[model samples]
Target: MIDATHDTNGTRYKLFSFMTHDVFGHGQYVKHALMENEGSECLTDAVTSFKYVNPTWEKVRVIIVEKGFGDISLL
Candidate 1:
Protein backbone atom coordinates (compact mmCIF):
# COMPACT_ATOMS: atom_id res chain seq x y z
CA MET A 1 0.00 0.00 0.00
CA ILE A 2 1.11 3.57 -0.70
CA ASP A 3 -0.15 6.76 0.78
CA ALA A 4 0.63 10.09 -0.89
CA THR A 5 -0.73 13.49 -0.20
CA HIS A 6 -0.14 17.06 -1.32
CA ASP A 7 -1.01 19.92 0.99
CA THR A 8 -1.99 23.53 0.21
CA ASN A 9 1.68 24.46 0.40
CA GLY A 10 2.43 22.01 -2.48
CA THR A 11 4.50 19.79 -0.24
CA ARG A 12 3.92 16.16 -1.19
CA TYR A 13 4.69 13.20 1.04
CA LYS A 14 4.55 9.45 0.49
CA LEU A 15 4.53 6.50 2.89
CA PHE A 16 5.27 2.95 1.85
CA SER A 17 3.43 0.10 3.57
CA PHE A 18 6.10 -2.42 2.54
CA MET A 19 8.34 -1.05 5.31
CA THR A 20 6.18 -2.85 7.85
CA HIS A 21 6.51 -6.10 5.95
CA ASP A 22 10.26 -5.56 5.77
CA VAL A 23 10.42 -4.99 9.54
CA PHE A 24 8.73 -8.35 9.88
CA GLY A 25 9.58 -11.38 7.70
CA HIS A 26 7.00 -11.04 4.95
CA GLY A 27 9.22 -8.90 2.76
CA GLN A 28 11.95 -11.54 2.58
CA TYR A 29 10.17 -13.27 -0.29
CA VAL A 30 9.71 -9.99 -2.09
CA LYS A 31 13.37 -9.14 -1.59
CA HIS A 32 14.41 -12.46 -3.08
CA ALA A 33 12.16 -11.99 -6.06
CA LEU A 34 13.65 -8.56 -6.68
CA MET A 35 17.15 -10.01 -6.57
CA GLU A 36 16.34 -12.52 -9.31
CA ASN A 37 16.38 -9.66 -11.79
CA GLU A 38 20.02 -8.62 -11.59
CA GLY A 39 19.81 -5.60 -13.88
CA SER A 40 16.97 -3.74 -12.28
CA GLU A 41 17.79 -0.02 -12.57
CA CYS A 42 15.45 1.42 -9.98
CA LEU A 43 12.33 0.87 -7.93
CA THR A 44 10.22 1.03 -11.09
CA ASP A 45 12.26 -1.74 -12.67
CA ALA A 46 11.85 -3.92 -9.60
CA VAL A 47 8.14 -3.26 -9.58
CA THR A 48 7.91 -4.10 -13.25
CA SER A 49 9.75 -7.36 -12.67
CA PHE A 50 7.50 -8.18 -9.74
CA LYS A 51 4.49 -7.54 -11.92
CA TYR A 52 5.90 -9.95 -14.49
CA VAL A 53 6.06 -12.68 -11.83
CA ASN A 54 2.61 -12.03 -10.35
CA PRO A 55 0.27 -10.38 -12.77
CA THR A 56 -2.38 -10.17 -10.09
CA TRP A 57 -0.36 -8.09 -7.65
CA GLU A 58 -2.52 -5.75 -5.62
CA LYS A 59 -1.94 -2.09 -6.35
CA VAL A 60 -3.38 1.00 -4.81
CA ARG A 61 -6.02 2.66 -6.95
CA VAL A 62 -5.75 6.40 -7.00
CA ILE A 63 -8.18 8.84 -8.56
CA ILE A 64 -7.63 12.56 -8.82
CA VAL A 65 -11.02 13.74 -7.62
CA GLU A 66 -10.26 17.45 -7.59
CA LYS A 67 -7.44 19.69 -8.80
CA GLY A 68 -6.50 23.35 -8.70
CA PHE A 69 -7.83 25.97 -6.27
CA GLY A 70 -11.11 27.72 -6.61
CA ASP A 71 -11.53 31.46 -6.97
CA ILE A 72 -10.29 33.30 -3.88
CA SER A 73 -12.63 35.74 -2.20
CA LEU A 74 -11.11 38.76 -0.46
CA LEU A 75 -13.06 40.76 2.14
Candidate 2:
Protein backbone atom coordinates (compact mmCIF):
# COMPACT_ATOMS: atom_id res chain seq x y z
CA MET A 1 0.00 0.00 0.00
CA ILE A 2 1.13 3.54 -0.73
CA ASP A 3 0.92 6.44 1.76
CA ALA A 4 1.90 9.86 0.53
CA THR A 5 1.07 13.46 -0.18
CA HIS A 6 -0.87 15.01 -3.14
CA ASP A 7 -3.64 12.65 -4.22
CA THR A 8 -2.93 11.23 -7.68
CA ASN A 9 -5.02 9.46 -10.26
CA GLY A 10 -5.56 6.27 -8.25
CA THR A 11 -4.29 4.44 -5.20
CA ARG A 12 -5.34 1.73 -2.79
CA TYR A 13 -4.54 0.07 0.51
CA LYS A 14 -4.34 -3.57 1.48
CA LEU A 15 -7.14 -5.54 3.16
CA PHE A 16 -5.24 -4.86 6.36
CA SER A 17 -2.65 -2.14 6.87
CA PHE A 18 0.27 -1.73 9.23
CA MET A 19 0.50 1.73 10.74
CA THR A 20 1.48 3.42 13.98
CA HIS A 21 0.55 6.62 15.77
CA ASP A 22 2.09 10.03 15.18
CA VAL A 23 1.67 11.48 18.66
CA PHE A 24 2.50 15.02 17.62
CA GLY A 25 0.59 14.80 14.30
CA HIS A 26 3.49 16.47 12.51
CA GLY A 27 2.17 16.48 8.93
CA GLN A 28 -0.43 15.34 6.42
CA TYR A 29 -3.96 14.10 6.97
CA VAL A 30 -2.53 10.72 7.90
CA LYS A 31 0.56 10.48 10.02
CA HIS A 32 1.69 6.89 9.87
CA ALA A 33 4.77 5.63 11.66
CA LEU A 34 7.47 3.39 10.26
CA MET A 35 8.53 0.13 11.80
CA GLU A 36 11.53 0.29 14.08
CA ASN A 37 14.10 -2.37 14.90
CA GLU A 38 13.05 -2.25 18.57
CA GLY A 39 9.45 -2.97 17.64
CA SER A 40 10.54 -5.79 15.34
CA GLU A 41 12.57 -7.24 18.15
CA CYS A 42 9.66 -6.86 20.55
CA LEU A 43 7.36 -8.64 18.12
CA THR A 44 9.76 -11.54 17.81
CA ASP A 45 10.56 -11.88 21.48
CA ALA A 46 8.53 -14.60 23.21
CA VAL A 47 8.11 -12.54 26.40
CA THR A 48 6.64 -9.63 24.53
CA SER A 49 2.93 -10.23 23.91
CA PHE A 50 1.42 -7.18 22.24
CA LYS A 51 1.74 -3.47 21.64
CA TYR A 52 -1.15 -1.08 22.03
CA VAL A 53 -1.58 1.26 19.09
CA ASN A 54 -4.07 3.87 20.34
CA PRO A 55 -4.48 5.83 17.11
CA THR A 56 -5.35 3.10 14.59
CA TRP A 57 -6.78 0.54 16.97
CA GLU A 58 -8.70 2.71 19.33
CA LYS A 59 -9.10 1.71 22.97
CA VAL A 60 -12.53 0.19 22.27
CA ARG A 61 -11.43 -1.63 19.09
CA VAL A 62 -9.54 -4.88 19.28
CA ILE A 63 -7.66 -7.11 16.85
CA ILE A 64 -5.52 -10.17 17.35
CA VAL A 65 -2.09 -10.66 15.87
CA GLU A 66 0.45 -13.44 15.74
CA LYS A 67 3.62 -13.09 17.78
CA GLY A 68 5.63 -11.44 15.01
CA PHE A 69 3.16 -10.02 12.49
CA GLY A 70 3.20 -6.30 11.92
CA ASP A 71 0.72 -7.04 9.16
CA ILE A 72 -2.22 -9.39 8.92
CA SER A 73 -3.27 -11.84 6.17
CA LEU A 74 -6.03 -14.30 7.11
CA LEU A 75 -6.65 -15.34 3.53
Candidate 3:
Protein backbone atom coordinates (compact mmCIF):
# COMPACT_ATOMS: atom_id res chain seq x y z
CA MET A 1 0.00 0.00 0.00
CA ILE A 2 1.10 3.53 -0.63
CA ASP A 3 0.94 5.90 2.30
CA ALA A 4 1.46 9.62 2.64
CA THR A 5 1.40 12.32 5.28
CA HIS A 6 1.32 16.06 4.99
CA ASP A 7 2.06 18.72 7.55
CA THR A 8 3.31 22.28 7.84
CA ASN A 9 6.83 21.17 6.96
CA GLY A 10 5.92 19.30 3.80
CA THR A 11 4.49 16.07 2.42
CA ARG A 12 6.01 12.77 3.33
CA TYR A 13 5.33 9.65 1.20
CA LYS A 14 6.10 6.01 1.67
CA LEU A 15 5.27 2.82 -0.16
CA PHE A 16 4.73 -0.54 1.47
CA SER A 17 5.29 -3.86 -0.30
CA PHE A 18 6.74 -4.42 -3.77
CA MET A 19 3.62 -3.04 -5.38
CA THR A 20 5.32 0.33 -5.14
CA HIS A 21 6.87 -0.39 -8.51
CA ASP A 22 3.51 0.24 -10.13
CA VAL A 23 3.38 3.74 -8.68
CA PHE A 24 6.53 5.13 -10.27
CA GLY A 25 4.53 6.97 -12.90
CA HIS A 26 2.41 8.71 -10.30
CA GLY A 27 5.48 9.63 -8.30
CA GLN A 28 7.16 11.01 -11.39
CA TYR A 29 4.16 13.16 -12.15
CA VAL A 30 4.30 14.68 -8.67
CA LYS A 31 8.06 15.16 -8.88
CA HIS A 32 7.75 16.94 -12.17
CA ALA A 33 5.12 19.25 -10.74
CA LEU A 34 7.33 20.12 -7.79
CA MET A 35 10.30 20.70 -10.06
CA GLU A 36 8.30 23.09 -12.22
CA ASN A 37 7.51 25.18 -9.17
CA GLU A 38 11.01 25.26 -7.72
CA GLY A 39 10.33 27.98 -5.18
CA SER A 40 6.81 27.17 -4.11
CA GLU A 41 5.49 28.79 -0.97
CA CYS A 42 4.11 25.51 0.30
CA LEU A 43 3.22 21.97 -0.71
CA THR A 44 -0.43 22.96 -1.17
CA ASP A 45 0.63 25.62 -3.62
CA ALA A 46 2.68 23.17 -5.61
CA VAL A 47 -0.23 20.77 -5.89
CA THR A 48 -2.56 23.54 -6.91
CA SER A 49 -0.16 24.64 -9.61
CA PHE A 50 0.01 21.11 -10.92
CA LYS A 51 -3.74 20.86 -11.23
CA TYR A 52 -3.89 24.16 -13.04
CA VAL A 53 -1.23 23.11 -15.52
CA ASN A 54 -2.69 19.67 -16.14
CA PRO A 55 -6.39 19.80 -15.78
CA THR A 56 -6.76 16.41 -17.42
CA TRP A 57 -4.90 14.73 -14.60
CA GLU A 58 -7.60 14.85 -12.00
CA LYS A 59 -9.11 12.42 -9.51
CA VAL A 60 -6.13 11.68 -7.35
CA ARG A 61 -7.01 9.28 -4.55
CA VAL A 62 -5.51 9.97 -1.18
CA ILE A 63 -6.32 8.41 2.19
CA ILE A 64 -5.91 11.11 4.79
CA VAL A 65 -5.34 9.87 8.29
CA GLU A 66 -5.33 11.78 11.52
CA LYS A 67 -2.65 10.67 13.90
CA GLY A 68 -2.03 11.71 17.44
CA PHE A 69 1.36 12.33 19.02
CA GLY A 70 3.66 9.26 19.02
CA ASP A 71 1.31 7.35 16.72
CA ILE A 72 2.99 5.68 13.74
CA SER A 73 0.45 3.57 11.89
CA LEU A 74 -1.04 3.62 8.44
CA LEU A 75 -4.73 4.33 8.34
Give all candidates' CA lDDT scores: 0.32, 0.31, 0.34
Better candidate by lDDT, 1 or 2: 1
Candidate 3, residue 9: lDDT: 37
For residues 1-75, write the lDDT of model 3, one tens digit per residue: 222333323443321211112345542223232222223244345445556765654455553323431223311
- After TM-score superposition, the amount by which residue 22's alpha carbon in candidate 1 deviates from its true location, in angstroms, is 15
Across 32-57, the per-residue lDDT of candidate 2 in tens digits comes to 33222223342233112222323333
Residue-pair clashes, model 2: 0
In terms of lDDT, the poorest run of 10 residues in model 2 is 42-51
Better of 1 and 3 by TM-score: 3
TM-scores, in order shown? 0.28, 0.20, 0.29
Per-residue accuracy of model 1 over 1-75 as CA lDDT, tens digit each = 221123423322221112214435463333222222222243345455656765545542331212331211210
Candidate topping lDDT: 3
Best of the candidates, TM-score: 3
Candidate 2 collision pairs: none
Q: Which sections of candidate 1 miss by over 4 Å? A: 1-28, 31-41, 59-75
Pull out the clashing pairs in model 3. Answer: none
**Model 3, residue 29: what's the lDDT?**
20
